[model samples]
Target: MSQMLALAILILVLFIGEAVSIRTKAWIPSIFVSGVLFLLGFWTFFPPEIVTLAGIPPAVAVMLIYLLITNMGTLLSLQELKEQWKTILIAISGILGIVAALFGIGTLLFDFQTVVVAIPPLVGGLVSALIMSEGAAAAGLPTLAVFAIVIYVVQGFAGYPLTSIMLKKEGKNLLEKFRNNELTAKQLPGEQSGTTEKTVREPRMFAKMPEKYNTDFFKFFRLALVGYLAYLTSVLLTPVVGISPFVLCLLFGVIARSIGFLERHPLQKANGFGFAIMGLLLFIFDGLKNATPSMMVEIMYPLIGCIVIGVAGMYIFSLIVGKLLKVSKEMAFAVSLTALYGFPADYIITVEVINSLTKDEQEREVLTSHMLPPMLVAGFITVTIVSVILAGIFVGFL
Candidate 1:
């Protein structure tokens, strides 16, 4: 296929997936739909080089990871994180559960290599999958690399309905409490009762810069600078600290943002986030080029086993920790499941459940106030922070 034609087809598939996700309220994820289409295309007549033809090479994808993750760092709110400490504890416990269960039961059922490749993606998302796939490929285990991607592709199917059900149950329970006056909007956990307390804004380093002078090019330069510093830090510290460059990128991004060296969501501010994400997605799907129907069939048993075992572990641990922490079991489990599909899905599911349960604006506000914080915090902790760290650690086992 011509380069332009290939790129168009890729974008069309992405557009279709996104449209479907929006219409269904993300009951079906865009990545799932896009992944299936890519697999089918590759299995049939589509050329293996289609992703390259579309102008997203591996190096481009790697570069995007740095920029995008650095941008992700700028999105952190230290105050919000501090307030949601219980949610953070529960989220971490849930990940530990996945790790223990997978290492114990998963290794017994599958080979050590299969379990290793499956665990990171099970606990995280694309970056974890990318880390594991690249590690597996470099270790000369193409099937395991494909297995990592497959886990990322299908795990959301397991997470979405389960989280939706949990959130709905929790929402209904909270609504009942609200109706009976047992709970007030001000009584919601993790929410401030009123805005009586003043917040002191930290001084930003670029505060004096003219608005027009803070151009997109300048934003990109700041993001790239942080990314490069992250790379340099990783090079110097990896042997000493054993952290990956990507993990350092996320950390430095957070530090850079905290110090006001970078703005919040810098890539989005620069209008480059979507294209960066597109390039990364193309790089991820490019792995599908080597996968055959038989290879997929071969990994099915281990794939299914890892997800089942991992989620079961997460649920069990989250429930135990939630009970001890005095959190609702439903809310805790829903938060734990953020590992499966983070961010907008977590946000979407919370809103959808609240909307479905009540029409009262006050009730909606009450429910959102109680539920959204834990869910969002859990996602940031697991998918954004823990996963990359875990992937960096897990990849070495391969």
Candidate 2:
């Protein structure tokens, strides 16, 4: 297929996917729909070079991811984080659950290579998947490397509906509480910071930036510069602090917001950034086109086993942590499931859940404010940060 035809097919499939997602209320997410469409399109077009066009570099993809997460930081409240530390803790516990479950049972049932490839996708997104696959390939386990990508393609189905259903359920519960006067916007546990009257000191981080260059473009450029600085800082500090660059991006984002370098609105308004994310999603789907049917069938048993066991572990750990944290099981389950599919889907499902359940403006606003932070943070901790770090370590073992 010509490049133009490939690009046109990509756009058309993406459009149809979005239409399906909306028409179905995201019971079938756009990414998954588009992924299937791409798989079928690949058979028809057989354009071997399509993946090349969609093949964004890891650094670029990570930067786009960092930009998204950093923007998320600007919307977060330190006080709310303090109040909802339990949710954050639960998210970490869920990751641990996957690690424990996958390594423990996976080693016993599957070969070492199978265990290695299966574990990474369970941990997070395409980055982790690719990391494990490359590691396996380097170790001369070509089949395992291929299986890793296959798992990455299939894992979204595991996460997408669980997130959608759980969020919808939670939203309905919140709506019921609201209608019965049992819950008030101000009384939402994590949102007490916004409800209370307290004076907070403003940190002028952007005081160094002259007001003359404060156009939207300049503001976004400044944000991107800070993100790059954060990346460089993470590289330097990785030797000392031993945290992933992505995690450091979160810290730098908060710092940027505090110092007045990053503004929430500019990120919220960054159309290009949003499109980049969509492109990344397409790139991930495009990878699935490379997987032959025989490969998927060959790994089917281990694939199902890994996902099933991983999910079981997540739920079990979530229940224990949720009880200790005083969070409900539904919320715990919802947050933990984010490990399966991160970011845009999590964000979209959370919004859909809230919108579907509430008609009141105040109720919707309160629910959104309360839900978004944990959902976003959960994805960040499990998918972007911890997963990559874990993949790095697990790959070493492989």
Candidate 3:
């Protein structure tokens, strides 16, 4: 679709979603609305030109990728990254383990010719996966593109449903805690804040994240350094030593964060997120330009399947994890669901419910604070795993 048309459709969807949200007191989960938008975009704006060098299409795509990357990087402010160190470490382990296990399993089951080559980017994200997939195909794996998109579809949608079931109990407990008073910066009604004077102020001050930062060339340097290191390692290992790039990126991010290198730099945080995302989109779009209609359709099935699995898995598993974390029942639900679907769905659902129940600004901020990081991390992890698995499956060397 044309870029403006695509953006218009997205805005319209958001408007409709918000309108329905007001009416139903939650995000409108009606499948029909999404379907209509899908049709409108597909029929009217299925973009043309295979790698256009001079056109609005190419420029728009480039801008989209740039914005995406910048936003992702900007999210990584030093203090915020520091606060997330422990969880990020855990996420690294899980992401690596998942990518390895899923790749091995897919290879063993299908033993496809050379899908392993595409695995890194799929796990990394579409753009990264696209790079890996293209490299694989150039090396003789024709199905790489299909696999990368398949992974995206799976991780994108599957996370929603699965997290819902998993966090059911956690959600309940979080509600109770909200009713109680321990999980707050300051106590609410019928509670005393004699010692929580400072606690209450922290939430107000830290609730909003600053979006702007000073320009620093070093920040971009660190980001490029990480990317280059990961790229070099992935290229050498995948071709020579037989390793995956997805793991390479995760390792690089971890190392960058661990040594007080990237974390110590204020500007590097944003640069890191932005580059990762933008580079990824550039890669994915490039792949899309090369793909035929047949290839797109071929990948659609897995997209549907994987998304279902991701959503179902999260919903079913979040409750168990949420309980362990001791979050409230509803809050637990919110956490688990948001774990992978961090885009905005969780906020839509939880905020709707919270607003209906109470106008407590403090409560809303607390819930958002506790859940956002985990959700973002979960998205990164899930996307990576899904990418790798698809890569393995796509190459047919399995």
Candidate 2: C-alpha RMSD to true structure equals: 3.8
1-398 in candidate 1: lDDT tens per residue? 89899999999988887777666654555666787788899999789989988899878888997897677666555655577789999999999999999999888889999988888888787788989999999999988988998888778768877887788788889889989989876343212355221332222687776667888999899999999999998899867775567667767877887777887678877899879877877776787776678877898888788999999999999999999999999988999999986754566567666776777999988987788767877876788678888898889998
Q: Can you tell me which runs of candidate 2 are displaced by over 4 Å?
A: 1-5, 51-63, 186-213
Q: Model 1: which ten-residue window has the lowest total lDDT?
A: 194-203
Better of 1 and 3 by lDDT: 1
Each prediction's Cα lDDT score? Answer: 0.80, 0.73, 0.44
Q: Which 10-residue span in candidate 3 carries the lowest summed lDDT?
A: 202-211
Which digits, one per residue and each the tens of the lDDT, describe model 2 over residues 1-398? 56666666677888897788777876676776787777777766657557455445455565667677666666655555566677778888887887788878877987766776687678688889889989889999888888888887788778877777777777778777877988766443222354331332222455455656556677668768777887788788777776666666666776676555665535655556556666666666767776677777788898899899898888899989999888888899889988888776778778766766656899897788667778877887788877887788889877
Colliding residue pairs in candidate 2 = 205-259, 206-259
* TM-scores, each model vs. reference: 0.76, 0.86, 0.53
Candidate 3 residue-wise lDDT, 1-398, digit = tens = 45555445444654564566456543343222332343344345544342232232454554433333323333334345456554444443334443454445444544343335433433345544555556555766566545654454334234433344333334345556866976753222112336352433211222242324323554555555665676678787765664455445545555554443443223334444433333333333333343445665776654444334333443344444545555434443444334333333433344444454345677655554554445454544444444445455554443
**CA lDDT, candidate 3, residue 327:** 40
Give the poorly placed runs of model 3, Cα more than 4 Å off: 1-10, 17-36, 43-79, 113-118, 161-172, 186-359, 377-398
